[model samples]
Target: MAAYEIKFRDARELAEALKALGADMRSLPFFDNRREIRSVYITDVDVRAANVIKQEMLSRGGDAAVHAHAVDCGVTESDVILFGTVKQISFLADKLETMPWWGFPDTVKVLREALASFSKKPATIDLPSGSSLAFGGRTLLMSIINLSDDSFHSESRTYGNVDVAVARAVEHAKDGADILDLGAESTRPGAARISESEEIGRIMPVIREIRKILPLMPISVDTTREKVAKTALEAGADIINDISGLTFEPGIARAVADHNAMLVIMHMRGTPETMGSMCIYSNLLKEINDFFDEKIRTAISSGVDRAKIILDPGVGFAKDYSQNLFLLRHLESFRIHSKPILIGASRKGSVGKATDSPDTAGRLEGTLAVSALCAWAGVDIIRVHDTKENKKAVMMAEAIRNADYA
Candidate 1:
C-alpha cells in the first residue's frame, strides 16, 4: 500500500489534478468547493451577526471565531473570523441573506463578493487603445523610465533627455516588459515636488517619441497630478499609475474615466515629503485593506470602471523597513479586492536594506528575489527597474509554481 498527500495551491489546481486523473468532470465543481479551506476575517461585526455567523457555520460543519463575550451579547461589536471551505461559506452566505437584523443582508452580499474575488482567476483589463491585457497566466512586468533627475535610482534618471528615455522604453519592450511606466516627478521620501508644467515637459516628448516608435507598447504615466495624467493620456499614454491612491487629486480618477485609460491606484498615507514619518499603523493588513476599500469606492464613484483599476500596496511608500517586508509577505491578502495587483519593489530602500547592498548595481539580486516572491504570490504586475533579469526571475518562479503534478 502507498500513502501520500497531494499538494495544490487553489481550487483550480485541485480541479486540474482531478481532471488529469480522469475523475468525472461533473463532480469537479463539488470537489473543488470541498478541497480548500478559507479563513475570512470580517471586522466590526455586530454581536447579533457574530452569533448568527457562529450558528450558521456550525450548522454547515464549519466554525466562526469571535470574542468570548459575543455569545452573551456582552459586546456591541466584535471582529469575526470564519473558518470554512468554499462550500461551507457559500451556504452561510445564502443563509445570511434571508436574515433582516443587524445588517446581515449586507454582510451576506459583501461576504459572497469576497469569496468570489478570492476564488476568481485573474481578469482581463481593457485598454483604451482598443487592446486588452490579460492577467493570471503569467506575471506582467512594468519597466521603469524615470524622466526626473531627482529619481531615487541614479541610473534610471533621464531628465531633459527624450531620446534616452525613449531608447530605454524600446529596450524594455524588447526585454519582455508588458508595460512601460514613465515618471517625471520623484516620489521618494523627502523628494522635492516639481511643477505640473515641469513634469509635463519631462514626460511629453518621451511619450510622443515612444508612441511614434512602439505604437503597440502599453504606456503607464506615473504621476499624482490630474493635469499631468490628462496631458499624458492625451499624448498617447494608456494608463495612469497614481501612487497617491487617488487622494492627491481625486480628479485624476475622473480623467482616467474620461479618457477610458486604465488606473493604477497605489496606497500611500501622505505626500512623499511627509510619508516617511507616517509609517504607523495599528493593524498593518487591516488598515491597508480598509484604505483600499475607501479608495476603491472613491474611484468607482468618480466614474472609473472597476475593471480598469489596479491596486498597488506601495511597498516603500509610507512604510518602514519591517512593514515593507510584511506587506510583501502577505500580498495574497489583498486578493479580496478582486482587482489586479501591481507591486513596485524594484531597487527600493527595503531591497537595499535586505541584501546589505546600498547600491543599485548590487541590489539587482534582491530585486529579482522580490520579483520571484511576487510571482509566487500571484501578483498581476511587477513594476521593476532591471527588466530582463526580473523577467527571467518571474518566469522561473512561475515555472516552478505551475510545474506539472504527477
Candidate 2:
C-alpha cells in the first residue's frame, strides 16, 4: 500500500498544485469544497520512512496526522497523518529531501512545488440511482434511443411513440446497456430545435413507461435545459446527458446537483444549430482537454459531485469530418481527467462521411467500427444506437485487453 498527504491552504489551490507536482494531472480525484486538505502518499516500504518524515514535520513546527493511505493515491488504509496546514507541509517536504529514506525525491519535490502553486476547485457529482461513475476503467455504455423522426441515423429514431421506445429500452437493457440515454430532440447539424413542451411531451412518457420495467437500470435524460433535467429526474431519470455541456441552459447544473443526479458533461463548442461552423481547432485534442477542465470546474462549483460526473468528447457535435476522425483516434487523451468518458460517435454524420453512406441507417458498420476502437482505447462508455452490436464489440475488445493479464 502507498500513503500520501495532500496539504493545501485551500481546496482551490489543490488541483493546480497537484498538476505542478507531476501527479498525473488528468487522474486527480475530485475534491469537495469543504475538504480542503492535501494528501501525501507513501508505499508500505516507505511507511517507516514516512513516519520518520511525519515526526520531522511535527518537530519543524508543522502539525500532521498519519493515515493508512491517501485518497487520490487509490491506497486503502488509515496509518497516515492528515497535515493541518500548508506552511508546515512546505517545510516538511524540504526536510524529507535531505533524508536518505526519501528515495523518490523527485516525486516528493514535485508534490511540494504543486502545493505552492495550486489553484482551481475540483468537480464533483452525484447520481439518483446511488451508483457513482468516475473516470478510469473500461468505457461505460450510454445506449442511444432517439425519439425524433429525422435523426441523423434512421435506425435510431423512433416514431416518438411510447410502445416503440419502451420496447427499445428493454432490448437495450438485454443487450447489456449500462445506461439508457433517452433523447426526444434531433441534434443533427442543421436540425431545428423543438419547443420545450414538445420535447418534454415526446420524451417524458417514454421515460415514465420504461421506468416501469427497467426501474433499476440508470436512465440518462439527453437535454441541455434545466426544466428537462428537472422533469426527467422527477420522472425517475438517473443522469443528465448534456451535449451543450451545461453551457446552453441557465441553472441546469444546480438542478443536477439539487437532484443528486449524475451529469454527462459533453464537449461541444456551439449550439447544434450552428455547431458545424465552429468545428475549427488549432489543436483539437488540447482544446477539448481545456474545454473539459473548464466545464468540470464549473460543474463542481455548481455542486455536482466528481464521482457522479461523466465526460463525453462530443465526437460529431461540433467537429468537422477530419476533426471528428482525429478526436476518435486520440480519445485516450481524455484520461487526464480521470473521469469516465462517454463517446457518442454512433452513426453520426462523421460515420456517414467516412463510409460515404448518405443514409444514417447505412452507417451501422462504421458505427460498430468506431465502437470497437473506443473499447480498445479503454473508453468508459460508448453511446450508440445499435446496442447489441456495440456490446459485442466491447466484449471482444475487453478480451483483447485482458489477454496479457489472463
Tens digits of per-residue lDDT for model 2, 1-406: 8888744433335666666667865554444333444444322324445556666766865544555453233443324443534555666667666765435385365446445433322433335765444444455678888898988777777888789989999999898888899998888888889899988999899988987898778888899888988998898898898888878984778888888888889998778789989977766776787788888898899998777778888887888888889888877567656677788888888898889998877888998899888887777778888888888888887777545311
Determine which window of 10 residues in candidate 1 has minimal summed lDDT: 122-131
Q: On a 0 to 1 TM-score scale, where does candidate 1 land against the true structure?
A: 0.95
Of candidate 2, the 10-residue stretch with the lowest lDDT total is 117-126
Task: State each candidate's clash count.
Answer: 0, 46
CA lDDT, every prediction? Answer: 0.89, 0.74
Give the backbone clash total of model 2. 46
Could you tell me how far off, in angstroms, the CA of residue 321 lies in candidate 1 after the best superposition? 2.1
The candidate scoring highest on TM-score is 1
